[model samples]
Target chain A: MTASVPAIINEFLTGSFSTIINVLKVLIPLMILIEFLSVYHVMEKLSKKLTFVTKVLGFSPSAVLPLLVTVVMGVTYGAGTLMEMNEKEPLEKKDFILIAIFFFICHGIIETTAIWGTVGANVIIISAGRLMLAGAITMAAARLPFFKP
Target chain B: MDPVVQIIKTGFIKAIKTTLMLMKVVLPIYALVVIIKYSPVMPFLERAFEPAMRIFNLPGDAVVPLITGLFTDEYGAIAAASQFDFTAAELTTVAMIGLVCHSLPVEYALSRKIGLPAGKIVIYRILAAVVVGLIISRLGGVLL
Candidate 1:
């Protein structure tokens, strides 16, 4: 029984390693590229454009940075920024709800793109669709009688 | 070293580190799916998701991916979505829905740390996702 334990452990270890490797093959390169873009502040220019668009959805211009960053980097990073904003100044419940809704609808662009790409889907379409859907939902929610914040 | 070379080297190292960090979060989830796929217990859970899957217009096989997304994140859903031959609109609709409600288990745990009610959050999230998905699918069909 003791001898058999090593064989079972080895099998599990090998399986996990290969699985990790397979996932990393796509995840690694994407992470690196996204991080570099984030570190360099390359998305700043686009944030201005997003600010204008977000205003139509009932979110403040200030909400655009976290939303755009989350779209680029992923939700956790976006939430981190929001947490920082909350530290500096508490966000209105409405603003928080909008931001949360947006992030909920889309994020982790690189990972999503890669996964979709693998299956022959258009990465751009997937990304753009999420953004548009989030915008539409937020706008529609704002108009609803029951949606308080 | 040349300025360009120096920049490239620095960027490469930064990228690698970022990649590793991402992998740390993503790999375990993938491994878990592998185990679940091979395990006998998932079939029953798969069956339970059938009704939910129909509501979303997703096939029966999609239940596993959707369940995985609830435990992990949207990555699993995207992996599953990739396997199917969904149109751009269908994929987008599925992603929109998944994003809203998926990752409930993991996110609820995180929200709990912040003093939020996990159950309420999950319910709200699912409601938001489903509403948005159905609306988008209809709108997309009508407009595009």
Candidate 2:
């Protein structure tokens, strides 16, 4: 049995709407929490604490803002901040790639939560796997001759 | 102004903005997938994509979300996945791939804007996602 055009459209509308509803349930609260955290300067403290890790990752402490913001807000926000940093004072190419690798694997808490959590994916696997993989990849990439800064 | 009110106001506005941004990607893919299901192209495409997806122990239908998540966003992938019947492990693999690499075009553009090589970033991200998906699906029970 083939579905008609109208049926397809109906399915599309309802399907997308329902997905939006489901995603929003998790995303909205997290967005709110992220906003409040930033509003209360929690991100600043978090960024500060991450400085040691950044240094170990071969990035200057200034990379912290992009790293933290990306983890919370997504790639665009982090890129925006990185662009700003580049304008003020450029980051090393090695640090740039490392940060890119990190954010590429694990950015946007709301996005990860909504997409994975709504589908019954394991929280530990999604979160821990990405972090561990990102770390491993960045470490390996750091060993590359092109990455020497 | 009270601090509580300020937090609520800021959070509410941010949530609305984020939802709208997600809708931009999710709604279109949702419509596209719905239309594709009615069209004849799905079967041929499914057959072509199925072999690759099997490595992750996913159904042919899982290709929809994987491709959607690659070009668009994870929400679009989630929307596509919702239409199918997948086990928890399969869902975890799909979600893991989405987590590792989603919204590639936009992200690559962002990477370029930040002065990184777009092609390199895109290649690395997709490769990482594939490798991670394979590992997760194979060793999920033991490691996870």
Candidate 3:
């Protein structure tokens, strides 16, 4: 097919609908799970365990929940939680950078799997590479003079 | 009322809202890509991106997914890449780069919403993706 105008329009409409459906399948269930986890304070507990790492990353201990949430969930959800944290306790500019740097690289484990899994990509490298890259950036950012407030 | 059940209800509502917000971004971009794909400019785009993509050892057409993933999300990129014939290594390289830099407009806006320096964040993300992709291709060699 030469991709006539009608065909292009058809692809756009149907493609948008199907892609939205596909994303919802993963997102809804995951959102529900995240809610349950938050209600139970599971991330809070996990954040406690992540305190050492957050400290090393130049984040206040309060950043742990948002970090863990973003790690498992994604930037959208994690940013929402981070905003809530900000309202309550006002994070520093550097802390935002550190959190953003970490989450930028290492967000949405299951979401990444869902998208890339179909192509038979290497999940380990994708996930681990993100983790290491984010870790390295956070570490480097931590050492910057501006990082200390 | 059980607090757990209340939480579930709130979660459902939030999920619906987030899904709609996501659709607003995904739909327009998907439509845009569809239009671009059918246009005569695709070859020009492929040519323009060829040199940058060479670092990942991907074909010129692979720029489609990289660009789509940069502006939109993983799904759009996957949709574009599915149209091409690529080896597993090439696909993985694309996936990794997509992972690093996908969904810029919405995500960067969210960073700004959270009081971060959004422009700096976006620059950091793209650079990280490029550097990481280069390193991975060098190490794996198979991807090359």
Q: Which candidate tops lDDT?
A: 2
User: iRMSD per model?
Assistant: 6.7, 1.8, 3.1
Model 2 misplacement above 4 A: A4-10, B141-144
Off by over 4 Å in 3: A1-21, A146-149, B1-35, B139-144
Better of 1 and 3 by lDDT: 3
TM-score of chain A taken by itself, candidate 1:
0.74
Q: What is the C-alpha lDDT profile of model 1 across B36-141, one tens digit per residue?
A: 5545655766687767766655555566655666766665565444333566656656665666667777777755653345576677777777776667656555
TM-score of 2: 0.90
Error of 2 at B87 (Å): 1.0
Q: Give one digit per residue, the lDDT tens place, for model 2 in A1-149.
A: 28876777788888888888887787767767776776777867888888888756666787778888987777666777788888898887777777887888888865676567776777777877777787777767766787655
Per-residue lDDT for B98 in model 1?
66
What are the per-model numbers of colliding residue pairs? 1, 0, 0
Pairs in steric clash, model 2: none
Candidate ordering by TM-score (highest first): 2, 3, 1
Residues B56-88, model 2: lDDT tens digits? 887788898888888887787888888778877
- Model 2 lDDT on a 0 to 1 scale: 0.79
Model 3 error, position B3 (Å): 7.6
1 or 2, which is superior by TM-score? 2
Using TM-score as the measure, name the better of candidate 1 and candidate 3. Answer: 3
Model 2, chain B only, scores a TM-score of: 0.90
Model 2 DockQ reads: 0.71
